[model samples]
Target: MAADDVSVDDKVKRTRDLLSSFYSQDASQISPPSNTTSRFATLDTINTTSFDADQYMNLLVHKSNLEGLLQRHVEMAAEIKNLDTDLQIMKNNIVGMEVNMEQLLDKIMSVQSKSDGVNTLLFEKREHIEKLHRTRNLLRKVQDCKKASEEVMLVIVNKLEDKVSSDSESIQARAEAVMLLKQLDFPVEKLESKLLEKLEQFLEELDLSKDTSSDSANPHESINEGIESDSIPPRPEVPTREFVEAVHAYHVIFPDSEQHLVKLMHDLTTRHFEAAKQQIQEQVSSAKLSNRLRFIWTDVLSIDEVLPEAGLQDFAYEAARDVLKQYVTSLFSYLLHEISDALLQIQKDGIGEEYPLRAALEASKNALIQGSTKVLSDIRYLLDEDLGLVLKLRDMIISWVQEGFQTFFTQLNGQLLLLSGKDVPTDKVSSGLVLVISQLSVFIERDAISRITEEIGSSLLGGSYEYGSSAFYISMRTQRISVLLRKRLTTPNWIKHKEPREVHMFVDLFLQELGAVGSEVKQILPQGLTRRHSRTESNGSTSSSRSNQLRDNRSNTNRARSQLLETHLAKLFKQKMEIFTKIEHTQESVVMTIVKRCLKSLQEFVRLHTFNRSGFQQIQLDMQYLRITLKDNAEDEAAVEFLLDEVIVAAAERCVDPSPLEPAILDRLVQAKLAKTMDQEPVAS
Candidate 1:
């Protein structure tokens, strides 16, 4: 019972406490406001309400209702708390979204500002482009104006050129006319003055008139005098009958005489026909005739019926008289040409020595002189043409004098050599023969001077065939025995021309010995023997047969090799000669520039000697070793250090240093290695 009572009391206290809990009170607030609804309350007020049974029976029923309501309110409070958490999260998200919106607005404003700036720039640029277009149009107009001006200037220049050309030609023509007038002694100004004076006098006479009646008696007397003069003209200077007869004679002889007779007649007459005929006939009969010419032309022809040498003099003389100086010059030229042809024939005919056409040559020379004299005299009469004729005649005569004697002397020397059994005369030689050589020297010297003058104007001491070893050889060969004449002449102090003074007997002996030695050398080694070789040989029987074949093959190969080498070497030598001559003629600066280029190119070719595999490999290895010694701390420097050093050293050594070139030594060692290539190549053969 005590436990039950105690339990009851405890239960009552619990029930009362539970009822109080169901109608819980709020803290921090006395009561809800009169306007506030009881249905809702704050969370702190709801947490105080908790245990409820039935609100202690009857009151428990109302309490139960209150408790159920309180329970629903508690669940509602939990849902509200969850809704508050969701609302807090949503508020934070909305704040973040507002910040993002502010950022986006700032970005949009910035982009708009940039667009506005770009538009402003574009507008400014467009204005500048328009300005440039305007400038271009103005420049185009100015350029057009300039081009038009240039065109006008060019046309003016062309017109000026044409005018200048025409003026130049007119000036030239006037100068030529003046020269011709001077030659003819025309006195053009004096003649013009005299003609003007005569016209003025005639005009004055016409201007002066008189009365016919007062001067009638004078006029009648004048008329009577004029009629008397006309009737008997004082027996003119030359009679009409004489003039008519002379013209008739001239007409008859006109077919036979060319300009010679016409010129003579014209000179004598000057309008008096009879005087010209008388003078012409006297001059023709007085001309001299050659006797030697008569002997050869008449004698040679009469001897041989098949071989004819006639009408040469008459033809030569007639040609001279008809063509005057031109004919004579042509005759001399033809004589020289004939001599050259005869010499060529002598060589071709193998006439050997011991014989020469001396008589025939002498006859031809006599005929040439007679013809030459006639033409020269006739040319003298044509004073205007004479200077040209004299020059041509001198050139032709000089040529004939040089060539004719040269041929004669050369042939004579050969004959003498053969007759004397190649024993050239070592004693006092003939002066006449030496004189011929001296004449040749003079001719060559004069020709050289004239040729050089034509090419480079007058200069002192013009180019010459240097009288040296070559000159001595030519003199000796041309005048084999006559070479000894220089010694006899040299001893005499009176001798002025010492050009061919020395008589070297040793020259003849040397030539004879050289000729013999050359023949022996030619017979022994021949040519291209170095090209033929073999290491192996067969047995006796085979060797005999094979040796003959081998010899025949070698002979043919040697001959071909000799020919090819000769031909190629000749061509190469000729090219080298021409190049050397050209190089000598070129300016110093041009040669230096060319040599520089050649050396640079040669250096490039020489650099090819360093091979890529072994040579370049060893070079790279040595370079690496050199770099290691240079700087131990180097990283990338090791790669390029040696390259720099080597390049600098090589350039300094090759370009800065001077060295002697041993050609013989280089050729044997250096060129020997290149022999295989040099053999097939087209260099210097």
Candidate 2:
């Protein structure tokens, strides 16, 4: 109030006098506070009223000499300058406030002018409203709120429609639009349907793109045929950038459709793999199946890197795993189915008298090697390529690869694997799938696990190899080979034959099969360490399972052969011999098992049948030739010799009046046969 009482001219003059005294450079120019003549003013720590510049200067000099005096003088000057600055700032602030106040006043005046005009118009309207109908005005008032709400809904829908694009921005806009519509009590069914349509369109475009890609003269087919081909194949175009954009847009829009998204990824991957498979020429395609999948593995990893990771972070990996598993399943099924069909057709068409057992088996081996190679490659890629970040799915898939192959063999068609309980006729070439699968199992056990261990740069497949599925394959292959052997050697035709001629034809036929099995083993397995084996068969009462283990145990002569034991004795010629089993996947190991099992079958036949001297001498001739032949073919020549001698002993034991063949006569017969086999017809060259 007192400041308001002073005139502007007087205030300016008073301020000039105060500022002039501060800079006058005289000690007496400074003034002390008076507190407006009030009684409440009290002395504080600085003691301003008693403060003397010369006294403070003397105290500083006494404590710190000339530097302390000069420091104290500078501090006092700083305080004075700060006080002056505060006053100047306050004056400027007041001036700024005054300007703001004037602007506010101008705005108030403008508002007042508008209010006056509005009031004048309202007064005129009030006078006119008194003359209008009351009913129409009431109707207009009631409709106002409804019309406003509906118009707001329309505006939001239009904004949302504009945002329907293949981008994250569109997804965000759609979310906001849907939320607003829900808040405003509006139905969003149309917009949601539109979005669903976009999702389906994306999936369809992806599928169609994949389908179109396969409709051309692809060069990959020619590569396996040893022909030169270009890298670029004539195929349908793929939607590259659009595909990524579509993926980014749909995941957020349809977050709950995780299964749908997974299926979409699955379809894309499966289509890719199938196309790759179809690109290989069927004639030479077996060896290339694994190589194609290696490229697919790289592609899958790259896709995992590219796909949007929002809600579907693991979708690509899930798709790849599912696709890979199905692809493997398809490989087994196709190989089995193809071989089975060929055999059936061959039978139906009467192509051969016997299952071209050797060729049929060789085909199966080649197919399985490619399949195992494919699985191994996929495992290597998953573990070595950014495994930690690409989702912790590496081990899961690798385990599947390792375990799945083993389990698959257990389900193989029994008849195809030569497991038929009924008699398999000698003419039917037992399809070699059982043996191929067995060799495949050995491959995983001996070679695949080793390579996988090396590939991971770890210690031996992470740890010691679990028995896993290799054991099943080995057991099965053994069963099938045993079945194939007994079906021929122990048949009524072979056991009850009344012949006294050249060595039994079954020996040569059985040897041919062994050669084929050995050849296949060489292709798919490592050159395993040679193992020396010593085995003897025993005839005794036993359960079904006991017979399974006796392939590793012994036989007694006085024992009355029981159910399973009698079957075993007859299967192996009633002599001590190694049964068909899981041997190393090597040429020698596989062939030796077949030979031992075949010899065992011969021994059982000799013991079961009542043969005269002629039958005994015929058996003796075959045994002596095998003694020479098997020594070279068998893994352990000593075991072969011992087994061959036992077969003769079993025949002699079972013979009626077994007259021993003279040494000179036996040599002449064996030599004649050996020379027949050794002599080669002259070549045209």
Candidate 3:
């Protein structure tokens, strides 16, 4: 036991020493200890000791427990081996999972790179599209402005075309076009200037073309012939129709130019009128004057026809009127100056006693007749001989001549008053005035007034009535002359206070002359020789007594009465033949004219003046006696009586007093004078 114990102690010590050495050596090379022999020797020296039964039995039982322990050890070894195999399989699977994870990571990186590239390309495309949209909007604005401008230009073109084609085109359309252009921001002023320049250029080209065409058609023609070949020959030279139309086009486009053109036309007319005035001043004969006037009229007509649409016709007509007025004024001035010179000469020559009043009066009458004849002949040549003038123009000329003669007579009367110096007797002056009036009446009534009446009648009736053969025309002429004389010659002004006595004496002379004609007419009519019948008595007596008285008276009267009848019958037949001779030579119209003139003159003269009571009474008595004498000769007794009554009433209204005499008083005086004249008529008869 003691040996075994020592061996165990030795084995423990060896194992400890070996573990110590193994731990102290290099760590890479690990082994059990290098002193293994010592340990085995220690195990071999363990002593052999004697065994006991009790111990043996215990040992066997413990051996059974060792077998059971061995079996558990064997199962633990098998579990360790299986766990090793599972660990190897897990390591292999881990290697395969790592390879798959690497492949998936590579795929995800590639996808991310592709997505970034796509985003870059999309951003560039978006910018490009936005720029295109902005450019398109700009182009659209420019297109809209261009379209508006084109529309305005079209409207202006249409207006210009219309103005060129027609004269009556309204200018309002062009004006509206100009307003539209301004609203569109167009340059209108510059456009208008360019358009005007174009118009002028076109006009010039048109004129040049016309001239070239005319020359080509007549190359061999002379300059004068070329001028004459024009459609409107250039006497009163004015613009052609085409040229006027072009100018009018300009006027429509620019209205401010019209007044300038009108002034140019007016100046041309004035120049022509001045030339006509000079020609008239130089002319001496009536024939030359008439020719010049006709030429002026022709020129006016030519000018009017040349540019009829240019508003120049009225200006031409006015120019002609002024020319005519100048000619008429010149003629009248010449006649008046001559008459004044003659009157002055007569006054100077009659200053001495050698030229007696009667001789001076005779000389004055001759001078007046000579001057009047010259004037009348000149007037007659102008009015009656000149045939080309229209009727309306001729009538105007006649009126001008009448007014001129009136002015001439007025100046003559003034000159006569200056020459007489109030020394001439009223009776001599009255006689001279009567001679003058008679000559004027003869010329006016027989030549001027009668011809004018015939012309008017011919025009109105279209020349259907002959002057001498038609009784109606003769009667109309007589009535016309009577009216003309009353209205023009013996008007109220003729019997006014300035020359009252002259016209009154003329009335007296006319009545006396007509009364002598009536006396002659009465002698030819059988009514003048007839007498009123006498009444017979019807009382009766005894038959023997009545027979004795009747027989004694009858036998004595028959013897004497028979001788008287035979002698008177032969004388009556002689008087009848003489009456027939006078009747054959007389004109009833001449008698009627004289009676009417006398009655009108008396009526106008009495109506124009107021007189004293004595004068009025004397005039009334004369009127009453004249009324009785004129009743047998007057054409209308009622007309004559009414005119005389009007004259009496008018004279009473004009009585020269604070208060005029009543009309009733004038009636009473007229009646009293009439009764007195009527009482004297029977004694005179």
Cα RMSD for candidates in order:
46.6, 32.0, 29.6
Stretches of candidate 3 exceeding 4 Å from the true structure:
1-259, 278-284, 310-319, 346-367, 384-391, 422-472, 475-685
lDDT of 3 at 481: 42
Model 2 TM-score relative to the real fold: 0.28
The lDDT for every candidate, in the order shown, is 0.34, 0.52, 0.46
lDDT of 1 by residue, 1-685 (tens): 8966964674464444434553456432333345543332221233233313333233424444776667646855765676578668878999999999999999999999998999897997889999999999999999999999989766755554344235344322333333344344544343333322332332233311111112122212323567653233122122222222332233232333233323322322222222222323323211111111122223223322211223223333332232322333343454444533433332344545444344333333443343333333332222212222233344444344334334534554454344323455645444333333344335435653344223221111121222122223323333432333233223432212222212223333423433443343345332321211111211111112211221122233345344334434443432121111111111231222232222233223323332322222222223223333323322223122323233322322222111112224323433333353357557636
Task: Please provide, for model 2 over 485-541, each residue's C-alpha lDDT reduced to its tens digit, 9 standing for 90 to 100.
Answer: 466445644334464546666666656666666676678656657655423223311
* Residue-wise C-alpha lDDT for candidate 3, range 17-68, written one tens digit per residue: 4445434555334333456664343332222123244554444345537764
Per-residue lDDT value at 123 in model 1: 95
Using alpha carbons, what is the TM-score of model 1? 0.15
lDDT at residue 169 of model 3 (Cα atoms): 39
> Which candidate achieves the best TM-score against the true structure?
2
Best by lDDT: 2
Task: Compare candidates 1 and 3 on lDDT and give the better one.
Answer: 3
